[model samples]
Structure formats: structure tokens, C-alpha cells
Target: MTIAEDRAVELQEQIRLPRSMRLRLTRNGLTLVPITQAHWTTQRRIASQIEERLPGWTAVGEFSVIPPREGYSPEPDVSAVPSDQVLPDASKFQEDLLRFVVEVVSPESEERDYSTKSDHYALRGIEAYLVVNVLTARWTLLTRPQGGTYRHAVTGDFGEKIEIPVEDQTLVLDSSQFMRV
Candidate 1:
């Protein structure tokens, strides 16, 4: 391997990985998720919906979710880093840091968000991972990952709602408008 490749690999090893994603060294610099305009639009809607409801709870837009020993935010989907060492500086996070990660599935990103990320997140013990599929107009909620995969997942169609738990707290994710997809 090239010296640069070896150095990057070493850096990944030194960093902590969250449950939902992985820190990969690629020619593209780094890749977290496949993000798109449709995904962003739906994500904004979901965020707005949360802001309108949920008491004592903060609905952050692309904010951090601090995992175990470090903190890192995935592209457009989620962020989680451990707080013991504090924020940002603990940089470089993968899937496990997140309590939850939401993906508004676009055709371009659907496969990655649903299968690839789902498997990675489960292995790291991320509590919940949501896929709001714009194409199908359905929201897929996956939980209870065992043996590195989510064994339980419920697909709530548009207009249907799903209740999710975070940090041992339950919060409702409304899919009322999403059902129209």
C-alpha cells in the first residue's frame, strides 16, 4: 500500500466508529451517504414536524448525537460522537455514534440508506435507523439489530405515523404527509 493509504488507515483505527456508519478511506476523500435534493426536502419536513411537537426535546437539523469516546456527524443523514472527550475535536465518526439516523430515501440513495447503512448501524448498537422512502411514500423504521442486522422493521405508509424512542425516551415521527408520495 502507498504511504498515504497506510497513514489514512492508521487514522481510521485511532478514531472511534459509531454504529450507523463506517470511516472509510476512499479516492473521493470520504463518503458517508448518498444525499440528494429530494432527501433534503423530506428531511427538512421531518425536522419541521418535530419542531412543532415533542416537548423538552430538541429537534436539530444535521446536529451531533455524540456516541462513546468521540463525536462525528455523517453527511446529511446523522451525527453522533462520544462526549467524554468533548465535541468536534473528537472528530471522525462512523455509524455507531447516532441514537438515530434518518434518511429520506431517494432512488439514488435508497439502496445505500436502506441496506448498507442499516446493517452497519445495527452492528454498532445504534438504537434506531429510519428510512423515509420518497419513492414509495413509506417510512421504514428498523430496530432491534442482532447479529449485525435489524430483525424488526415496520413500514408506515404516507399519512401513517410511527413512534420512535431516543435515549430511552419515546417520540412520535409523523408520516402524515409522507404517505402522499
Candidate 2:
């Protein structure tokens, strides 16, 4: 295992995070972040919307995604994977199985969401990464991952529609009600 992976394992074994907290291995090191009420509410709403629209896909809130790259295990606020795909491990979802990931930007996670995660997710070849900034009432959709970056990005206000191409179909998410509580 890589040095980062070893460190991640050590941290996971050493720290006992609360149920509302998540441990992430970023470029710098391990980080534990609390899930605020607003973050939870928004994630649940979005996950429900995705699951309702995409019948064959499973949308889950706040799950660990183990990417192949070292020094990065991000738990997206919402992660969608094919329902028929059998998971090798029930506790962790492999990066290859993730079709889409959403990160709801919080005050403390603006940079991590807008920059760090965008680069990392693209590098891992995640088909789509959506950044929902409730603070600014805007959203950014990154698609066409190539060369460790997204080739295309579309940004719009919360009231607009964000179209995401997932597999053979397009998932249209209506962001009209997304806001900070």
C-alpha cells in the first residue's frame, strides 16, 4: 500500500469519529468534518430527488468512495451508482462504481468542494461532479473528465435546471427549491 493509504488505515483505526462526522483523506492529510443540519437536509432532498427520477440508479447520502488514487477517500454528500452493480464490499463503494457525486458547499468546505474535489473526482474518472453552493444559490456541473480535469463545466443559479448525462440517459435536476435554511 502507498504511504497515504497506510496513513489512512492508521487514522481510521485510531480515531473514533462521531456518527455525524466523516473522515476524509485529502491531499494534505486526514480531516474530520461535521455534518451540519443544513448539509444533511439538503443532501437528503437531493438524494431523494435523484432516486425518484432515476429508477435504476441508487442514490445514497454521505458514503465513502474509495478511489484508486492514493491520499483521497472522499465521502460525497450524495453518490449515485447503478442499482444492479454488486458491491465487493458493503461498507465502501469503489470509485469505478460511482456514476455521479454531489458535494454541498459549506462555509468551511468551499475550497475543498470547488477546487480540491473537482480535480480529484475528475482524475478518478467520475463521470459527473456537481457542486451545489447554497451560500451563493448557484451550482456548477463538471463533466467530460479528461487529463485530470473536466473538459466542460456549466454553472447556473439555483432556480435553473442542471442536466447531467448518466449512462444512456440524462438526469434533469430541478434546483428551484435549493437554498440555505
Candidate 3:
């Protein structure tokens, strides 16, 4: 294999997901930005912070998140994959294995993150979904997935502590540090 291809293979093995931030490997090199240029750093910071705080969980950015059922789209901003779950490969991960998803709303990605992805995650039984709008520095947490949608939706500004209930426990997110208004 060529050097670049060999490096991709090596990176694929070393990257353990959720902890890698917004980085993705392509044939060219590592990609740290794919969604919005303005908010990529902020997005990466938020995902990395979550991974650091919740060391036991897998917090990955820009991964394809799909339902266990067939024919589900797998494009999400950030996904919190439970570390205890096992997957066959990196190409795809079952929705049931994902405990939460975080999508930062940029001007270019507001509609998709707010409406489309929310519907998909809820339909697939994802326990929690967080929508962060860095420009406004606001956060919305969606939980209690039922009837093909999240029954509970809570919104708060930056610096506020948001409690995200997932599985049988609660994950508290403190956005005071990174989410600047």
C-alpha cells in the first residue's frame, strides 16, 4: 500500500472514536473541519470536552449514526457511543449502541440538525440528542424517545447546567467554559 493508504489504515486502528474530536481521515490527510468553518473549533471543543468529562463514554464527531433497522441514513454531527458495546467494524455502528448525539447548529446546518436529524435519532431510539447553536450560545436537549419522536425537549442558554437523562442515569453537561455567547 502507498504511504497515505497505510497511514489511513493505521489511524483507523488508533482512533477509538468519541475521543477523536472532529477529525476524520481521508486519502489526502486528516480532516478537522467538515461542517462549518466558523464553528468547527467550537464544535470540536464541545465534543472533546464531553469526552474528557465522561471518560467512560465514547464521544465521536461527524459519524454516520443509523438505526439498527435497514435503510437508515447514518450522518450525524456527534454521537456518544457507549464504551461497553461491541461493534464489528468502524464503518457503521448500531443505533442501540449510541447513548446520545450532539449536533451543533450552524447557519449552513440548522434545518437538518434541528428537524431532520432529530426525527431520525428519535425514530431509531437514540436516548439523548443535544443541539448547540454556538452563534447564539444556546443549547437544546432532547430525550424520552417515543412514538418516532422525542417527547421531552428542554432549551437553555450558555453557562446553564443541563441534565441529560439517558438509559437509567443522567448526564450533566456544563457549557460555561466553551459555549461563549
Best by TM-score: 2
TM-score of each: 0.63, 0.87, 0.70
Write candidate 3's Cα lDDT for 1-181 as tens digits: 5565556657865865453334544334554433454366666776676677665676665555543233334456666667666354675676777878787776645676788678888888888888888778888999888977999999998898877765666667777754442
Put down candidate 1 lDDT per residue, 2-42, tens digits, no spaces: 56655765786687755444454444444454445556667
Top-lDDT candidate index: 2
User: In model 3, which regions exceed 4 Å deviation?
Assistant: 1-34, 67-72, 86-89, 179-181
Descending-TM-score candidate ranking: 2, 3, 1
Residue 63 lDDT, candidate 1, scale 0-100: 38
Which regions of candidate 2 deviate over 4 angstroms? 1-5, 86-89
Two-way TM-score contest, 1 vs 2, winner: 2
Q: Please give, for residues 1-181, the per-residue lDDT of candidate 2 as tens digits.
A: 5875786778776888787886666666666777777677778888888888887898876566775465567778887888887454565788888878999987778899988888889988999999998878889999999988999999999789888888888888888857674
Question: Candidate 1's error at 89, in angstroms?
Answer: 9.4
TM-score between model 3 and native: 0.70
For each candidate, the alpha-carbon lDDT, in order, equals: 0.60, 0.81, 0.68
